[model samples]
Target chain A: MAALSIKDLTAIAKKTKESMQISAQGPHTKITVHMGTCGIAAGAQKVMDSFKEVLEIVDKKDVILTYSGCAGLCSNEPMVTIERYGEKPIKYINITPKIAREIMKQHVQKGNPLKEYIIAKGYENIV
Target chain B: MGDSTMSKETKKKEKTQTIPDLNSVPFFGRQILIALRNRGRINPESIDEYIAHDGYQALAKGLTKLKPTDIVEQIKQSSLRGRGGGGFDTGRKWASAAKATGEPKYVICNADEGDPGAYMDRSIIEADPHSVIEGMALCGRAIGSTVGYVYIRAEYPLARKILGHALEQARAYGLLGENILDSDFSFDIFIKQGAGAFVCGESSALRASIEGNVGEPTPKYDHATEKGLWKKPTVLNNVESFANVPPIILKGAQWFSAMGTEHSKGTKVFSLVGKIVNTGLIEVLMGTTLRDIIFEIGGGIPDGKAFKAVQTGGPSGGCIPESLLDMSVDFEELSKAGSMMGSGGMIVMDEDTCMVNVAKYFIEFCNSESCGKCISCRDGSEAMLEILTRISEGKGKEEDITLLEELSNAIKEASLCGLGTSLPNPVLSTLRYFKEEYQEHIVHKRCPAGVCKALITFTVLEKNCTKCGVCFKNCPYEAITWKKKEIAVINQNQCKKCGICYEVCKFKAIERK
Candidate 1:
């Protein structure tokens, strides 16, 4: 592989950002499954599997699915956060396979949140 | 268009709903994420995702815009102390390494997070391995080292695999290997898995293990920056400390220094474990009060139990009582309160926890993990563990407390490495703060916390039983017998006193006496 120049690095970052943004502003919908060691131990993989099944069935091409590490709340593992473009991200806690399907269907596809399962809304202020 | 109207409708609906905002909840609101900026936000395995979040931008800036000396100066001005618990100045360590007379000076990242309940390092690598890599590269440029090694524990297989993949990706992107990012400087990092010895977390022992020698620590007569890793000048920083570097470089030292206390700058990531309600990884600014961390961020202890103490650091750290909960959590303050911030493992204990047993638990950990290089640590820890075990088992004498203190002082003074020196912290702190609890065990021959099975007995309180039969069903030893609408009776002859029944009882019917 050729060594990248400083310009190459910034261009790659820009291209990835654009690709991630499906619409003119951002992706239509984004789903993040917390999959840290604690989350995995609490069956986050199963939750992710459930979301995948629902997303495939729903077939929303503009929606992006991803996973990240522990979100600092381990006791509320198997957590999932759904963000509709230009809307507040809603984090659902203590999620199970059944709840993941419900979330993908009700929140991700239909744009209505499952209020009983929701832990919080919006993003944390990053430093 | 159609999307704009849909978003407007959803925003209106969200405003009407009562879902708490992330900033409104103290658990999320209280934290300031610098080192963990991309933790739950990005896919850790993807380089593009990391780069999109401005991941390697600092390394790029360091390589292109700044010289090695300038990088070191910026860090020195930041006052970022070692997060690996020694609280040493990071830039000073680098400056010494840069000035030290040696060829092939090494940069080592200490990822061997062996603290029993601590997973801060493991989680950092697993979640944001690139951040650590970028930090290491910056260190390499500053110290003029071509090669670096990350000595991670073998037990963290997932973390190791993710880190290995991260290294490969960085190299592929020209962020790691030869002539990184088209700069004149060339540097790379290698992973060295440790053999699961707790003492190997010490710098000298870790470097020794890397050099294919026994993982035992020698006296630090000369600092590792002068002679380390095959006797070459080496700059060793912990995983979290390395992870903090990129942000400092990107945002400038003043921004990093503005958040923390007078002495300690930047945020520290703590693994809030044990009996807390919200057990996980959290990053708070230095000098954030323990009360805020425990109650506000951690959501306090679980199961409605009264808070007895919180153990800061690891087995090498001390147990802080409820009185000091309001005290600010910084390196200086923690050490002043008889505890050191040893890699930020905060294990909360409830009222049910016995102080004597807690001391015994830590001493036993130290006793087994001791390298036995010196007589004081080897014999002293074994002797301390013996005394603590006797106390917990109701065999302690009146003079045992004095004897333990004397042994602790001797071990701290004469021990060869950090393992021996800090191992007695648990004992000393508990004896200082919970002296009455210890006296109760020795003088009254009773464990108030009912944790020491030898000192306590399990009984079913007839008035509170309510014929629940919950304890009877959950008891593993089958010691509790109950008929329909009758209070449960525990058969002491068969009872193992495992505390399962005590834990499973919902009506507070099972009593430990």
Candidate 2:
């Protein structure tokens, strides 16, 4: 990304991101990923790839992937947050490509979330 | 005309990408930065990059509209405390130095951060030296100091080199030299290299080293704010402490005070290292619960292991048990939990961490770093080290626990400086919280974590052993042997505690207890 000389960078970023938005599966679902330097290093890219690959196989590409930096834990990388329709976002830690496949197929497609994989269940309700 | 159009085209390309440099993350969302803003985000070697981010704006601002009192008042309202583990009020220290009736007033940035896990200050200097320089300039303007000294460890060659470059850049811009910002303020800074002494981290000892003396600490009884650094009024602030000053001025105190809890205002940075999942620096708002940091931010413990304890505040800090995981992180709360929010070195520990061994490891560290300036610290640390060594080695006495308590208390009370006074923190706090672990080590002659070599012995479980001969090949000392296809035996006498046999075994065969 090149640095802009004009003011209101947030607006430009928002516009760029909003323009690339795809149709949702049902309603709003905020998908968050731990994308810190360490997280990115810990095969998060492949995990993200599996998320896309699973969506392609099922004909569902509504899931949006977002990122946050390291939370001081380098051991757990590719942390995923899946917010279901009208449900709170549940964060899944230690996600690999294989884990991401199961999460998408069982957790996302099945609409029956795995409680064991649910590390943090955030209070933010998906509307 | 062609060159002008090319320049215009380049400018156009830049316009779309330009973003404000301020970090707007939720944790550091409200950090009005003096020192820490540029850390981890900038390359310290590049002088031009620092200027582009408005590095010296605070210095320029300090040079113009603010007097010494005005600067001090701004700090006072912000309620910024020293991040050098002292918790001293930053504004009060500056004000005292400002008001001190002396021929020369001094400002010293204590870059001698010798805490084992504490790199928040050093990383800032290495990543963005200009931020520290700008901070020192603001400090100079605030305390009415003309000359400043930065005493950094020689081990941090990168920090020293970067800090020097920043000083030169500021001078060329007339930010560090005479009539800064075209105003009546004139201030400059000098870099003082430290010879890797943990004692130099103490303010007086740091000051002595700046004067070309041996790195040793004097008492803080007379207040270094009055007669410091060559009997001149000196305001010595740690790197992290100084970094917080500029932002307090640029943004109002309400902005900073709004982020943290009632007493502890603004964001505090921690070097989130050790047994935890995350192993980097984390800057979070004050009052953020310890649970959120260790679990959510830290991604919980690795290998599904339960968190046993978290060692906060470094060698001098105490081990906070999992019972206090929900504790809100502020200076006072941590202190109340028998741990200090020391210089922001937060090392997490899991169930595998032996309480006794961890305590012993810290005591050994403190023992080596101890300058032997006083009998209390020198002898007290030595005595404590011997006791802890005995306990970890399974040769400990039951009565030695009580003796350790008495000796540690005496050391804390009779110690000459903060080093001796706070050296027993790890031992005393560990003893208070995990006395049973020490009892297990001494009375039962066992280390539950299987960490201590003396307390643990390797064994070959017959049922699990595949007789693959992998253990025999991988054993560094050739301790594992197999007489038949049924089982493999580990020669206990020949076992070296290398753990290689335990690792290379495909079958979960090797066991240590």
User: Which numbered prediction scores highest in lDDT against the true structure?
Assistant: 1
Taken over the whole model, the C-alpha lDDT of each candidate is 0.90, 0.74
Instruction: Tell me the deviation in Å of residue B263 in model 1.
Output: 0.4
Cα deviation at B255, candidate 2, in Å, is 1.4
Worst 10 residues of 2 chain B by lDDT: B19-28
Best by TM-score: 1
lDDT of 1 by residue, B449-473 (tens): 8899889899998889889788889
* CAPRI docking class of candidate 2: incorrect
Query: In order, what fnat does every candidate score?
Result: 0.79, 0.09
Number of clashing residue pairs, candidate 2:
18
For model 1, the stretches where C-alpha displacement exceeds 4 angstroms are: A22-27, B1-16, B481-487
User: Model 2, residue A51: displacement in angstroms?
Assistant: 28
RMSD of each: 2.4, 11.2
* Model 1 agreement with the true structure over A39-114: per-residue lDDT tens digits: 8999999999988888777765868899987787888988887888777788889999999888777777667788
What lDDT tens digits, residue by residue, belong to model 2 across residues B1-513? 999989876764453223222132222222333345554223455545555555555665665667667878888878888888978888888888888878678989988888888777766776567777777888888777899998888887656776798788667666677777667778889988889989888888888889988878887777788899998899998888777776666666666667778888777878777777656666777888888887766667888988888889988899999889999999999999888988989888887789888888888888999998889889888999999998899899989999999999999989887888898999988998999999999999999988889988889888888888888877778787775565888898999997888778878888988
